[model samples]
Target chain A: MPAASAIKVMVVDDQTSMRAMIRRALQDLGFKDIRDKPGAVEALPAVKTDRVHLIISDYNMPDMDGLQFLEAVRADPVIGKTVFIMLTGSADREVVQKAAALGVNNYVVKPFAPAALKEKIERVFGELT
Target chain B: MMRRIPIVQGEHAVVAEPGVIISTLLGSCVAVCLQDPVARVGGMNHFLLGEPTEGLGDRVGQERYGVHAMELLINRMMQQGAARNRLRAHLYGGANIIAGLGAIGSSNAAFARRFMETEGIAVGRCELGGTKARKVEFMPYEGRVRSSVVADAPPPVLNIKPLTPPDDGDVELF
Candidate 1:
């Protein structure tokens, strides 16, 4: 696992405030290379070219939703193994099952404190340090 | 005797008596409020999308689609003794929180207006657009609505919980 400062992270959501919040949380956790995208459609091209270590995405969005985006990322030869964490407002069981089946590394419910988000990331990456 | 009823995403409620308030929070989604003043009955729906597509699979879990939600609201109002011709509509929500994506809020607002116009229903008022999400309240019996722009996104807690599945038979997921 990469160190917190060395990890390259991508935050994708339809809401600007959400992206900002997540980015701030990542920064507080000592992540240096963090990129933000408004939605999945805007993130794809960059994901292919950029060496993003982890992706935090929202479930609901216009055009391409988070699940469809996850499928797309998995299908990509270069970025298929990239870690993914889904953030949602509601804990819709079916959606969670689908995401788990799609190989999501972790899940975070919205309105979560920065500490909670850091804990989930630690679970996936084996501690932030 | 004022009562507050929350309508969550993919849900609708009809109230015939006065002093009943129906409310919902929205972001990039639309809520439609319909009321019949003469009958003192009104209803509201909070929908996530404008319409369902053929490729979107079954309509079972996609109750958040605008067409189905709108139809459901209208039918329920009529069932509660509200006349269709006497119905007036108020639109709320449909905000573009994301900056670059196509204006989904605009599209949803347009869809609602078109739906009401096609059905020969009068639109009394609309509170739509802008970049902020909104909290909307509707008093069905009184045909009154109040909306305010939410400064920060509220916690994503649904006011109404999903119905618990039956203990037996094939389990269906929402």
Candidate 2:
């Protein structure tokens, strides 16, 4: 398990309120190296230029939706294997299957609490310290 | 008197006359009313969720619940003699009525806008993103929309106590 403060995480969502809410939850979980982007358009470039260990992104966005962003990331040789967690408004089975097929690490539906966020992260990083 | 049709989540209606009014109630759900004045054809869809992704395999199926409600609306509009390039849009809903549900309303609204922009549709008037539930009535042929807030009192904030994840056999770890 990695230290929560050590993991560099990137959160991508188009909504300001959603971004702030997720940022607060990450802070509550002791995650210090958190960065947020309004949408995949900005996030894609940031992930390519910087070192982001984990990505938390919303599924729906302008310019480029989260699934397209995920495909772009997975196709990159350098960032192909990075841990990805998708955020969606509902828990539809087809969306789940699609994300899983795209090599996403995990997912969370909207209205999740900090505890729920932490649980999804732990499932990927195996319990953050 | 105009024919009144009320649609709920995941439903759409298309008409090509002046005697029908399509309506819906929205709370975090979006209704996109599209019309082509030249053809005098129009339709509306009330979508619960999902954004459009082009060229993806079974793209429509993989969207929100195996259906992209926006596409359904657009397709129905085209079928009723509305041209894709001439489509004008009026968007409504996507309200964050419940505080604890996160910004699902914003997501739905953003998706609707983005879909229209990507498809080259022009949005004329819109009412989106607030903390109140709304009642929307649309006269498709006239491309006119009348909206009123039916509920505006903010929901009680959730008192979330941190505890172990629920093990009610409903949590799927994927």
Candidate 3:
């Protein structure tokens, strides 16, 4: 497992409360290098210019949605391989299939417990000690 | 002794009895409550966006959009013997909690207000455009709506100020 301290994670959500909640969850898991963006538009630029090991993004957003943003990230040469996880309120199969095809690491549905989020992250990075 | 029914995102509920309450939590999303004074019947809808076309999926998913949700609420209320002419609307929970992202809350509020106007319904109250999420409790049969800012910690403050009815000529920010 990569060290939680070394893994730079980014959380993208339009809702400030959701962002804070995710940030708190990451902090609880002992993740140190965490950054948050309000939407995929802002996140895209940051992912391009900086080094982000993992990204936790909300599926619904204005301007650019999570699927479009995931497609953009997968198309990029530098940031294409970054670990990606999607969070959404809807459990729509088509949306899940699209994210899977675009190479998302995992999916976390909304109203999820912090433990569930941690499990999805650990599934990507292995169990955190 | 009100029975509380939670209206999740993309859902709408109607109640005709006096002791039923509809509730929803909002962040950028908008909830519209409509009650017919004469019939004592009312309904509420929680919509994520202003229009159905903004969604990128099947028609079924479009139901969550404001256009469909709003129509559903109105249609359901009418089915419950609510008179369209006697319907009064209350709006809540359009907050720009995150800075830098587009003002989806503002857009949702504007869409709801315009929809009511175009439908010939009168708006009784509007609580919108702040940096905090809201927890809304609505008594549909009584036409009573209470809203509070959702806080991170304890003691959620109830916002129970006198509502100044907005002029039909202008859209006001709260």
Q: How much of the real interface does each model capture, measured as fnat?
A: 0.00, 0.02, 0.00
Residue B162 error for model 3, in Å? 32
Better of 1 and 2 by DockQ: 2
lDDT of 1: 0.75
Give the docking tier of candidate 3: incorrect
- Of all native A–B interface contacts, model 1 reproduces a fraction of 0.00
Measured with DockQ on alpha carbons, how good is candidate 1?
Answer: 0.01
> Which regions of candidate 3 are displaced past 4 Å?
B1-174
Q: After superposition, how far is residue A94 of candidate 2 from its true place, in Å?
A: 2.0
- Please write out the lDDT profile of model 2 over residues B1-174, one tens digit for every residue: 989988777667998899899988878778888889999898888776633332224222223321245645665676677767788989888898877878878987887787777567899988999989888899888878889998786422233222221232244656
CA-lDDT, candidates in order: 0.75, 0.75, 0.75
Leading candidate by TM-score: 2
lDDT of 3: 0.75
RMSD (CA, angstroms), candidate 1: 15.1
Report the first chain's TM-score for all candidates.
Answer: 0.95, 0.96, 0.96
lDDT of 1 at B11: 83
Q: For residues A7-102, what per-residue lDDT tens digits would candidate 3 score against the true structure?
A: 899999865545766787788778999999988999999989987999999886667989999999999999999999987543345676788888
Q: Please, what are the lDDT tens digits per residue for candidate 3 over residues B1-174?
A: 669998777678999999999998887778898999889999888876633333234322222245545655765686788876788999987787767656877877777787777667899889977768888899988888999988633223233121111121121110
Candidate 1 colliding pairs: none
